[model samples]
Target: MRSERRHVLVTGASGTLGAEICRRVAGTGWDVTLVVRTRDARAAETARECQELGAQTTVVAADLADPGSAEFVVEHARATIPTPMAGLVHCAAHFTFARVGRLADDLHSDYLRSFDVNTHALLRLIDQCGRHMVDDGRIVALSSVNSVLGLPGSGAYAASKAAAEALIRTASRELGHRGITCNTVQLGLVDTPAAAAVTDAGVRDLYAMQSAVGRTGRAEDVAAQVSYLLSEQAGWMTGQTVRLDGGFQCR
Candidate 1:
């Protein structure tokens, strides 16, 4: 185990998957920063969960998509710890459904907006903290399996996530020279609030069966893989995507 007590920051802390990441890392005795939107009750829940897992948590309330919120988020959290951002996990996301024909110029901009939350905000946060990144500091974003298997009405969401992964790959190359590792985890269908958006029961059933494990993914399952990627044991790994879908996309 490393001597330095790491401080990990996770955005989208109000969501199921994001909260799970906090819980898993906290259990390992890391300091956690749970970034959430102001006045969100889920934020309290996440904070409570983190504390239960035995980690000190800093609750940061900010709109990650607001202009310049990225740097602000990083700075506020950094002020809480002296460790120079030992880890960053961006689980924040936005999803909009519209077919290409219905995607007007304004609607098309939604794709960019998704990127703003899921990709650009992450990029800016990394840029602000990358230089001071602790040795082997880990940066992992929660991408989606949809990035590879595009959904018709969710193309914008998928494209944004894919772009975010591309950015991470590039960042891994740049940051590796500075002793920071960057990677992404593309999650499959998980039983989270987000899954409620899918109205097609047949599609959901099909996805559950498609997984070799014969079930939908869980936040804990994804968080377990995330914990490994953030560990000292994973120092050699970077610029990769770990799929946490019960071997759904298997060989």
Candidate 2:
């Protein structure tokens, strides 16, 4: 039997990875609510793409860093969606490169900003979704391989992502009784606009060499994994961090 189409909420809908996830999920015939931080040209383009795929789409501008934003987003989504949301893919994250020395003064705000969006916002969204979603809802959050790899100059970002994963694990246990699954996907070097902006040819080559696939990952690669995790086939999986690093963590 064909599965009935469902509604999904995707954060960071304007970025490369998030936009691809929105497109991929919509292509699967699911209604999509894009929780973008800003209603930019990119968000509009992504929404247009999803609509073209025949999936109903709604774009909500929200900054996850703000304490009240999650509640507002939940209320907006509940009003806009024709049915209960079945899935939430949190792809929004704040990252700024800095060393341990920067943790003391003005740069302290950097850590706070990262944690506010990467960890606390995720918790707030999941809590709201838990109260409203139908049984068997799926929740997926985007993490980075740096969370575990202990990469230098990534202390704050890694700490925030690691904390997010810890929260997801606990959430899975708590929501399991309701048939909801929470999981995190850890990504490595992906060929996204963000990476392109920071990575030079030498750095890209280094990352490619470390991957078993001998090439960098694409945004679509991460999107495919998220799409699977949101499907009924992944109902039995929860409280786990799935890695899409092309074996970079193994090396």
Candidate 3:
């Protein structure tokens, strides 16, 4: 077992999927710097859990929507963590349900916000954090199947995620010479608080039915995949968008 502790920066660290990733990485001897929009109780709890798992934890509150937040997060992590950052996971996302042509007045702002948080922030983090990473570094972003499927009522969200995937692909190519791997995980209907807020129980059941696995995704599923991508064994994998949708896209 690899026991050397490496440092990692995880955005959206207070969200369900982000928190799960933090726990999984921490258990595998990775110290974590959690970048949250607010240093709330939930963020504190996540840091505590990682520390209990014997991982050094730092919580830096920065809203990714801000153009400069990415630089601030990297600098803060560099100052706090003793080790050079080995991995960066961009888990923070902005999602809004706006159908094209239906909400013309609101769609423009929504689209801008989505791209700002999802696409631009990921790019900025890759630029800021990527500079601080060691050789064989890993960069993973949590994307959505909507990026490809273009699900109805998710125009803004889908477009932003698609753009993020493209940026990851480019980053992978540009950073490959340094042994840095950049990838995205296109997720399906995961049972998360964010999902619950936007979808109803009926919608959830329908997603479960559509999935080939006959169930929705779990946070553990995402965390497991993230752990693998961050591992030294995955050094050769880059510029790929691996789907973790429980075969939902197959149907």
After TM-score superposition, the amount by which residue 55's alpha carbon in candidate 3 deviates from its true location, in angstroms, is: 0.6
Worst window of 10 by summed lDDT in candidate 3: 102-111
Report every candidate's CA lDDT.
0.82, 0.90, 0.92
In model 3, which runs have C-alpha deviations exceeding 4 angstroms? Answer: 102-107, 249-251
What does candidate 1's lDDT look like per residue over 52-110, in tens digits?
A: 87667788888777877877777888787665578988888988887766665666777
Tens-place lDDT digits, model 2, residues 3-48:
6778899999899999999999999868899999889999999999
lDDT at 203, model 2? 83
What TM-score fits each model? 0.93, 0.96, 0.96
Show where candidate 1 strays beyond 4 Å.
Answer: 107-109, 249-251
lDDT of candidate 3 over 1-251, digit per residue (tens): 25678999999999999999999999998999999999899999999999999999999999899999999999999899897798999999999898888546655887888999999999999999878899888999999999888878999899899999999999999999999999999999999989999989998898888888999999999999999999988989999999998878443
Q: Rank the candidates by lDDT, best first.
A: 3, 2, 1
Q: Pick the candidate with the highest lDDT.
A: 3
Candidate 2 residue 10 C-alpha distance from true site, Å: 0.6
Clashes of each: 0, 0, 0
